[model samples]
Target: MNTSLSLLADLLKTAQKEGADRADILFIQTQSVSYQIRNGKMEETESSEQNEIGLRVFLGKKSAIISTTELKPDEFPRLASQALAMAKVLPEDKFSDLLEASSPQRLSKNLELFDPTLPTNDNILAYITEMEEQALAQKGITNSNGSSAAYGKSHIILLTSNGFKGEYQHSSFSAGISVVAGQGPTMQRDYATHTTTFYRDLDTAKSLGLQAAQRALARLNPKKPRTANLPIVFDPRIAGSLLGHFASAIKGNAIARGTSFLKQALGRTIFPKEVTIMDDPTCKKGLRSRPFDAEGVKAAPLTLVEEGTLQHWLLDIRSANQLNLPTNGRASRSPSSPPTPTHTNLYFKNGSHSRTDLMADIKEGIYITEMMGSAINGLTGDYSRGASGFMIRNGQLAEPVAEFTIAGNLNDMFANIGLANDLEFRYGVNSPTLRVHSMTVAGA
Candidate 1:
């Protein structure tokens, strides 16, 4: 066994000897470096390295967790003893238990999650500098907020007394730029970013900077349209928020508590038949891809929504047990907290229409490129948010618009959703450009 795995196994043994009925250990190591440039100068450079261990002990129905950065062999006994004592005084939770043992499935293919070509400080600084320079050179771009480049890698090792042991490592690289256009009261700001598991897959710094500058320039001199019920389109950049809200409304915990708006919508058609949402944890080189969840359960792709019908809830072991269902392997955890249900790489399937095709028939509509604030009621699915973008007129984008509020109930919005074919996996939770038939626009 590896040193970290051996250490965790020893910790689990110590916990068992300390009177715990069950136990698990998690070890993590991370390293990261980042560089930022502003106004043609390198403004900051930062780096971090961390190694930590977390221990969880269960005494029948009671459990407690403890964590430490110190990996010294002598510390295991004290950590285990402390956890056992804590568990003794805690209230029993019927749902808290380790997963049953099963034969582990080996990955069918390489995930390509790690990139060994670590960029030096100078390389990161150069990328940021070039991005900032490119953004500042754009016409009408008055200043730069900043350009940044970062790289990070994380290693996770999980061990449990129930014969589950797994370890994995992943890497990430990203670059971004934010710039301001126009000047004074008419000034507008926008940003662009690109991230990838492989260093070579990241977009060029120059391209990112140019995109940011162009976006900011396009937003100069904004106007607010008259209040009315109008079609509202979401840019791919912010369209994922709609999917996020839907994901939250179907979480197992919320459903179990009867607090989710989608709690009673299971097996019902909640959207157009063309709409399908998915969560996959095994995609090669995916940002959040993993072979197994934090609980050592094998991870697989889940069709959360199939043909517009709610199919599954995001669940962890505890929530699944409470709901009397099997886990979907969505459990996530941190050193200081127990496992919780979370998404890996959630996204919607592409639709038949292109962005232009979706907008072609809308004589008047708001194409939302940016959103601010959140006014959502999870229980009712009532949604409202400040929005800014360009107005779509006669099948073309025309005139910048801002300072407007879009309001609708999610149930209606989902049913009315019109998706475009421009889906890209730039973000972990991604969607193509989407349009809603009608929404109340609160504006001038």
Candidate 2:
């Protein structure tokens, strides 16, 4: 065992000896470097490193969590005693308990989660400079907002009083550019960025800069259309927001607390028969992949929605116990926080129709590429948001539109959703182009 793992194991043992029935320890060390450039000059540079340890102690049905940056052997006894003292006075929570004793699954050697190669700080700065230059070279791109490149890696270790013990490491690389187009009152801004587990998989700086410039230029002189009810198509970039909303609504805590719009939606046809959604934590090189949950439960794929019916709620041990359901291995946590349910690499299944085909039948509508602000009622699913994109007229993209509000109930929106075949796994939450039959577009 490595030094950190050995230390964490000893910490758990100390907690148990200090009047605790069960205990768990989590350790995380992270290192990151980032560079930012604007107007062909380096504006900011940053490097960070941190290590933290969290201890959780259980005394019968009462448990308490504590964390610190101190990781010395002599500190273990004090940490254990402090945590147990807190647990002793806390009110008993029947649902809060460790998983039954079981061996944690070994992490796969071929997870492809870490990249050993590290780019020099000079290389990162060069990339940022090139990104900014490319954006400024484009026609009508007047000013650069900024360009940035970053790399980060994290090492994680977990140990419990039971048989569970595991560790893993993951790395990330990302580059992005944001620029303004036009000048004065008509200026518009847009950005493009890509992040990947391996440095080689990131999009080239030139490609990202050019994409940013084109998006900004396309939005120059945008107009607000007349108010009306019309079909609304969502570009892949913004369509994922719908899936995010769905994920939030189906979290186990939301369901158990009666706060979710889909609280009573399980096993019901809430969408079209063709719609399906999945949360997969085992995808190789996935941005959010994990070998096990924070509670040491083995990770597995889950079908959240199947053939229009709600199939499962993402859950951790506590929420699952409250609902009298088994956990789906979706628990996530930080060193200082307790476990909570969250999805990993969530995506909707692709549909047979092309994006063009989905918008071809619309006489007049909007295609949303960006959305800002939200006014969603989680309990009632009433959704309203500010939107910007292009007007769709005669089966083709027309002039750009902005400063509009779209309003509808999420339940109604889910029922009317139409998926397109352009799905891509570019983000943790992925989706294809989506079309809603009709909505109130509050434009001037």
Candidate 3:
């Protein structure tokens, strides 16, 4: 065991003996490595470190939390006193509960979160530089793109008064390239991706660069758009964004505060029957996988929406207490801010339609490739957004298009949206190629 961990555990035990009905302590340690290449040269390479801990105490109906970077015995009592004082002044909260429940039984394994033999910044830069050189080889590519790669590792532990103690560690890495093609009025740009929990999962630099160049060249001929209520096909990347939209709708905090559209829609069919949404924090190799969440609550897979029917809303300790339900282990805390809600590896299940097959069904609809601007009301479910992509002609991808607005009420979009079998788990929230019918398309 790490020496610091033992000392912290002792500190927590001491806090429990100091007249508090319930208490919890969290310890966080993190490190990051980042490399940036500019103009075919290594521009930046750096690392960061973070070490902090937080403590929460409960007294009767009131509760408060305090955190510090200092890890001394004299500071603990002062921090506790400050929290107790603050708890005395705040109004009684309905969601404040001292949880004494046991955790779910889960198959546990030690996940490998560190690779000491991973390439260093200099070696990684050499690879990125080589990639840019390859991208510039494309005939129409006017300017080669630089690449940025980052790796991060975080370790966290949680100890609660009710006999729950847990810890988890994880790692993440991402690489991206931006390419410019053509010249003057024909100038256009495109990008490509490579990201994973392990270094081995990334694509080679040459492949990544070529993909970026090919994507940019595909947008050569711009097409004009028109105002029509037609089916819009969302590529896998854009489709995944719907998960965030759903996350907002089912946040217990949002519902309790009367700020969520789904607040009054529990047990109702919120999305199509084929659209099943899950919050999985233990997905193998998932970037957000963990045994626990930011607040140290045990993490388990949750079905937020299943088979079109509303199921569960995300909950933190506070919100769960108020609802008299188990916490979902989804909360975040910063040095200056209190605990708040977040998601981990929220995924939408795949259907039975591929991207090519799905697009072939759209005769004259828009294929949204990129989304811009935010125009969704979290509380009302009203949605409108600026989009850029391509237009479909005769069931085939036709001319490139840009600067269009797609407007629809999310409450309606949910019920009418169709899922494609092209589901991909690229980033955090992943969905497949999605088709939404009869959205108001504003184009000239």
TM-score of each: 0.98, 0.98, 0.93
User: Which 10 consecutive positions of candidate 3 have the poorest summed lDDT?
Assistant: 107-116
Stretch of 10 with least lDDT, candidate 2:
102-111
Which runs in model 2 stand beyond 4 Å of their true positions? 103-106
Cα lDDT tens digits for candidate 3, 1-444: 277677677667666666567777778788888887866877788889988877777787777777877678767667777777777787776566544556644634544544444577677887788777777789898885567778887777777777667776777777778888898887778888877878888788888888888888877766659988988888887887777898887777887788887888888998888888888877777877777665666668888888999888788877777666777788766643556677888877887777777778677998888889999988788889998888887678888898789998888888888887766677888888888877999988
Query: How does candidate 1 fare on TM-score?
Result: 0.98
lDDT of 1 at 201: 97
* True-structure lDDT of candidate 2: 0.90
Cα lDDT tens digits for candidate 1, 1-444: 387777778888988998889899888899999888889877887899998888999999999999999777898789999998999999999997899977766753477788988987777888888888888998899998889989999998888888888888999999998999999988999999999999999999889989999999999999997799999999999999999999888888889899988889989999999999999998889999998898988879999988998889999999999999999889999977899888999999999999999999999999999999999999999999999999999878999999999999999999999999999999889999999999999999
- Give candidate 1's whole-model lDDT: 0.91
